[model samples]
Target chain A: MIVWTLLEWLAWGASGLILAWMVADALRVSHDYDEDVLLSSREGEMIMDEPHDAA
Target chain B: MAQAQAVTETKAQPIGLLRVLGPGHVWALGVGIVLVGEYMGWNFSVGKGGALGSLIACWVIGLLYTCVAMIDSEVTSTVAAAGGQYAQAKHIIGPLMAFNVGLYLVMAYTMLEAADALIVGDLVVALAAGTGVEGVDPKPFVILAISLLALLNYRGVLMTLSVNFVITAIAFLAIVVFFLSVEPWNPGAVLHHADLLAGLPYGWLGVVAAFQFGIWYYLGIEGTCQAAEEVRSPARSLPYGTMSGIITLLIAASLTWYVAAGLLPWEYLGQAITPLYDAAQASGSTGLQVFLFIGTLFAASASANGCINDAARAWFSMGRDRYMPIWFGAVHPRYRTPFRSILFLIPIAVSFAFTGLLDQVVTFSILSGLLGYTFMPINMHLFRKRWPLGSIERGYVHPFHPLPAIVLLVLCTATFFATYLGYGVQLLAMMSFYIVASLWFAFHRYKYVRRGDQFTMPWPRPRGY
Candidate 1:
């Protein structure tokens, strides 16, 4: 069995951190984009409602 | 579709990037741009450092790429322009630096595209030879490849990414297959090769030399940011795509090295153009060999197509900014794509492809890449000073502030010098580009700096956009 050196371990750890960040960010953005779509639709509806209310 | 058509016919809004891409699409582009390396070319590192040294170099390069990606994500999200690093450098640093970055980016992407076109030809010829197919010159196929990629790019961004996603997916799966096909670990084999001294054949110097090929593992990750304008939400998706893409590349690169080297001797693998296929063939799997041959073709296609998209976008941005002729800024009246710029690159790339100067082109690509990378640290620092936290809404603020960028700058600088020492004459082609750009800028200062054109900005969307 090949024993990993301290530097190798550190490299793995760093890569681990990046991978974790990637996953977390992907999930976060997926959720955020959903909310963004919902909010944008609501905003559009509000713009439509303004004309109706004025009428 | 009717509304889009009507909009197109009435006024045909000026050349602008379509916002049809999402994080996933950006991820595909990022992955596709570098997929060529995982399947081939990177094995050369083993010749320099053996297995262990090359692995170490890859780790360091991967870290540098991670840091560079993070910094780019932060800057890209905040700026959100098609110009990408060039725009950021312009806003934060100065025009001179921006021009340099823009030219460097163009050079990197063009050289990469040209190199990939040649590799596609080379791969097809090699495959034909192995399969007992008859004689054929690869030059026509090379031209056909470049023209085909240009046509896809000119069609639309959506088509480009869709094709990129499919091919990149295959390339990654091939890597996974390669990993799976490797023989089960033998403690005795590793013990017998103890003379490898933990895989470092020539020691630390070898590791330094290995940096050249090690960078291939993540050379084009930063290009993802160039698609910022087309992304649905740049602030969020840029980081997501770029960071995830970096992780995917790291995994693919490591597996590629381990499985290929483990199955075959590092020395033999070092000289292989189709290392992954060679490794799979070593496993006695005709099925795997054929699969890899097909995968190599698609991988080259994906890299070339994605790179042309990036190069055209950068040139279009430069044209819009008056850094180059406005003819490059022309968008197709009906297609709403940068058709002129895309077509313009075909001849230049085909010329380079026919020259058969893959080594010089790769050297030039790396030299320009390092130049652009060295500017990122400076851009980040200046950016933070110009727009501190909470002043502007941005995504993925890199922790520890300047450290990541600083480390990236150091790595890029060291690699630049190393590359120069190793391939100084070849890199003169890249230096010559800078001299030419300088001369052009000196003569055409007014056009290059006159600033009425509005580029996409994150906050307070630029007027006329």
Candidate 2:
């Protein structure tokens, strides 16, 4: 059987916790991004808001 | 009347760089360049440190990057320049050091772009061979892909970043699918399989040997900072983008290791360049295997695209600052992009890609990265001392003062030595490049730049601009 070392366990745990934190942050930012877009649309002139076609 | 005039004046100035990026683009650039780590190259660690030992090495490297990303965030937020590390080095260490740092980074990015270009060629042939077609020459296809990406990049930053964002998403999804498709696992079986546990035969020495591959997991996470100049708000987007990218990669690395190792004998997997495809093949889904093969191409292309964009930016920044030829700083009147720098990058990458020396090129790239990172900790301490908390417009100051920077520097130093010992005489290429840079600076560069407005040597005290 493969036995886990303390270091290995800690490493795994850190990865899990960090992953959770990142996912939560991503979700929060995504929501804020949508709201910002909506607000900017209402106010007009969102700064480079349209896509460019040329160099 | 004054406020109205100010708004009109600001709008009237010629648009520079089309500043269209946000946190998402920054995250995409960082994750896109490094995503290939989870797809391939990292399995080589299993050859040196066994499954368990390699996992440990991954943890150490991951921790080092966590510190690097955070510290780099602070630097990017403060400087907010296209030159990235090169720009930060200029303000802190002076022009001579900035020239070397910029040159090394440019070389590293160019080498990576060439290496990924070659990998995309190899994967195309592999995909064809999977369908019983054989002997298709990959050179033309590789050349085509490189040209197309360069042209797209030249057109606009929007094209470059939009494509990267989509491909990066697909690449991540491939990993998830591959993970779920893996065979049912037995933890006991992993230790019992001698082939899967090859690195265990050598003990701790094996773990030390695994450091380079461990680094692959998060190698290019800092590439985002290169886009600080393009972001709408560097102070907010840089840290958010970089931190999210690092943490996401950490998870992807762990789960990838777990699933790939658990599903197949790592000895066989370690030798496979496209480990995910091989693992999918072993999982008995030829369809998924074929899907992953295509995803591998996307992953490599995404990385190469990001590298090309970032490398050109470095060259542009250097040229603008008169560290190199000022002509290289020329922006396209139409695109407003650094057309000259991109033109320079293409020939170098194409010529190198044709050499078929990607393995050696990768080593040199790693050496450049290690050297570049050495400056971070010192800069961090210097920046903190100069502009202590609340004195400057900073984002995400690394907590616990200098401890994170100190740890990252120690880790970078150890990895550099380990890499030197591993590569040995092969690293003469990097040394020669450094010597060439020094000679250029001493003989021709200094005199030209000394009179220019860009020269910031004789390190000035912080003016709190």
* TM-score of candidate 1 on Cα atoms, chains taken together: 0.84
Estimate, for each residue in B1-465, the C-alpha lDDT of model 1 and write its tens digit.
765555434332222455678888898888898989888878788888888877887899898899989999998887777768887886777677888898888888988999999998787667556657545456756776786787778767888999899989998998887666554356334222343334577777887888888888888889998887777778898999999999999999888877776666777876787788887787777888888888888888999998899888888777766678765665443344566577677778888888998877777887888888888998888788777787678888989998898899888876876576578776776678798887778677545556544333434422233
Off by over 4 Å in 2: A1-55, B1-15, B183-195, B450-452, B455-460, B463-465
DockQ for candidate 2, please give it. 0.03
Every model's TM-score: 0.84, 0.83
Q: Considering the two chains of model 2, state its CAPRI-style docking category.
A: incorrect
- Candidate 1 error regions (>4 Å): A1-55, B1-9, B12-15, B183-198, B452-465
lDDT for each residue of candidate 2 in B67-147, tens digit (9 for 90 to 100): 889889987777777778888887776777788889878988888888888898787677667667666666655666677
Error (Å) of candidate 2 at residue B185 is: 8.3
Native contact fraction, candidates in order: 0.00, 0.05
